[model samples]
Target: MKELVEVLAKALVDHPEEVRVNEVVKDRSIVYELSVAPEDMGKIIGKQGRIAKALRTVVNSAAAKEKKRVTIEIL
Candidate 1:
């Protein structure tokens, strides 16, 4: 799950080396915190958060196969 977020963020950001993902596991859900270069934040989020929404959708779909609830936080 961590790798998935990292790969997605790295692909979207100019500063791929600066992309980072932190994972927090809970009994019922998992949280992924995605951090990118400050200048690349807009690319990850897109206009009106469309890209962010898509990213979350992809992650959630993958998590659904594992029967886990997942959340993505862009920072």
Candidate 2:
């Protein structure tokens, strides 16, 4: 999951080297905090946050089979 978000964010950002993903495990779920270069924020979020929403949806569905909760936070 961490790698997945890292790859996705790196692909969208101008400063791929600045992209970072922090994973936090809590009880039965996982949370991913993704931070990218300030200049690349808009690209990651996209128009009307469509890209962010899609990213979340993809992560959610992928984690469903494992019966675990997953969330993506862009900062």
Best by lDDT: 1
lDDT for position 46 in model 1: 99
Which portions of model 2 miss their true places by more than 4 Å? none
For model 2, residues 1-75, the per-residue Cα lDDT tens digits are: 788888888888889999999999988789999998888999999999999999888889878877889999897
Q: Which ten residues in a row have the lowest lDDT in candidate 1?
A: 20-29
TM-scores for all candidates: the values are 0.96, 0.91
Clashes of each: 0, 0
lDDT (10s digit) by residue, model 1, range 3-45: 9989998999899999989898888889998988999999999
Model 1 lDDT at residue 6: 92
For model 1, the local distance difference test gives 0.93
Clashing pairs in 2: none
TM-score of 1: 0.96
